[model samples]
Target: MSVVVAVKPSARKRNAKVGRLVAAEGTRHAFGSRAAAERWAESLSTGDGHVWIAAAHPADDDDVDCYLVSRATNAKLEAAYDKRRRRLRGGEGGKQQSLGGAE
Candidate 1:
């Protein structure tokens, strides 16, 4: 069992790009970009579930190449970042005051 994720342009937005995640069993999912989809797929692959593979085959008329990333790795990185951010904020997401220093 394996999953396939690909990045391509969006159908509704001319300037937007979308990613598609398709399982070998025919289940499909979509994401904002190839990186996002591959990240998700990588997470799934880390578990005891299906293996996730990223397909970067170029389109017939395109000259760009796709890439892949690990979801577990991304998750770890995000967790570390969030931890640092919380420390910087003293564990409280306080509201910002106006530049004039008045509430």
Candidate 2:
């Protein structure tokens, strides 16, 4: 499942004190601090569900992109593998478009 923690200020509340938590599935909640929101997201990220905390909406991004941004280390690992794979595939200087391209 794809989970994202949207930390944005409540527009309905005048001069909101903290950020609000909005899940990708439309689940809404409020958090007193960014740390609290991140913590909540981390809690939700367990077992099969890899939670992603985003301050802004991932409007143009696909699921894989969103999932990767959630974990920096995982993204780095993927990049490294992609470089090696591209080198084996005879990509330009071992740097192709990316791992999952249309071609």
Candidate 3:
């Protein structure tokens, strides 16, 4: 089953309660794997925005498994995203880094 990634605006002081999360325009995507979905969600997360992951609910087959991302995970995702961006922009040796070490 495919996983979905969605982005929405975060709750602010003026809007203490976040509204129902509906996938905004240009902010939803599907991936073949949970890891890929999480990575995409993390890349889109920002101070003013929130990201979520959804999958097929294990308990109820017709239900969706969804949750808001934690702040700590967002931080880690941001770090990885930045590192990737830098590498793409030639900050690294412009050599594609292998996912497996010592390749």
Candidate 4:
């Protein structure tokens, strides 16, 4: 599932949030699963722990770009994943992109 979610307010607004922590800098993050996305969001908001963003599998990023996301976004998004997944599978909410590390 090549799902992308903003780890921060800016990323969410811009709709470009996804990728591994190593490349999440200015760039947004894309996750492989809702669980992973939620996990990262939780870590970024709650802990002083490091957060990991989802990057294109073969990581084309050169520097670490991950950022901490807000907790509010995480909880709301948990249900959103299910809805979006439906849309993605039905090809209604997306274009030619894959939703979960598929394409």
Candidate 5:
């Protein structure tokens, strides 16, 4: 079976309720191998968002088991972005300093 990769955005509600991600319409791409699908998914995950991958027919979107793929660098990038945003909003932009003396 061919592997399918697509950027499926979260369908979670804004009120902090649980929700599943909805697949993008007409955005799925089929790859011949898992490695190739992973590569493409990783490429699409350069930012804070995640990409979804599943092994099944490209036409079948709902029944296959899906997994998320995110780049390792996304955590660091998201941290920096949050820090910058906080700084812009008049919050501490760096790590908190401990007030206690070293033992």
Candidate 6:
């Protein structure tokens, strides 16, 4: 089943969250019209579970071939990040540091 979802103009908050998950997976993403993005997003379902992101097909010739970052992946990444932040902070009131640091 192919479906299209319009892209809602995303702000830094939305984009930033997605970026990290795709990065964790060592993949690339495309940005463009929402309908295209949604189509790609919906294709990630597998027997195990839904994939978090579906990258644009390389065969695309359009000036802008949209890519999709799965909502599932986005949520997991955000949850993991939040947990790491809490762990690093060790307690409330301290500034959370980056996990990507010199590790």
- Between candidates 5 and 6, the lDDT winner: 5
Q: Which candidate gets the maximum TM-score versus the true structure? A: 5
TM-score of model number 2: 0.32
lDDT of 4 by residue, 1-103 (tens): 5556545443343232332342546444566776776686665434233344444334635432344342234546877887778777875656555567676
Against the true structure, candidate 4 has what lDDT?
0.49
Instruction: Write down the TM-score for model 1.
Output: 0.28
lDDT of 1 by residue, 24-103 (tens): 32234546666676576456544232334356555644333342332233457888888778867877654555789999
lDDT string for model 2 (13-96, tens) is: 211122122323333454665566667656655442344445544585532222212332345788889878879798866544
lDDT of 1: 0.44
Q: Is candidate 3 or candidate 6 better by TM-score?
A: 3
Summing lDDT over every window of 10 consecutive residues in candidate 3, give the lowest-scoring window: 11-20
Worst lDDT run of 10 residues, candidate 5, spans 11-20
Best-performing candidate as measured by lDDT: 3
Global lDDT scores for all candidate models: 0.44, 0.44, 0.50, 0.49, 0.48, 0.44
- Candidate 6 residues lying further than 4 Å off, grouped into runs, are 1-27, 46-48, 51-103
How many clashing residue pairs appear in each of the predictions shown?
0, 0, 0, 23, 0, 1
Residue runs of model 1 more than 4 Å from their true location after superposition = 1-26, 59-103
Which stretches in model 5 have alpha-carbon errors above 4 Å? 11-25, 47-103
> With candidate 5 superimposed using the best TM-score fit, by how many Å does residue 71's alpha carbon deviate from the native?
12
| Worst ten in a row by lDDT for model 4 | 13-22
- Of the pair 2 and 3, which is ahead by TM-score? 3
State, as a TM-score between 0 and 1, how close model 6 is to the true structure. Answer: 0.23
- Pairs in clash, predicted candidate 2: none
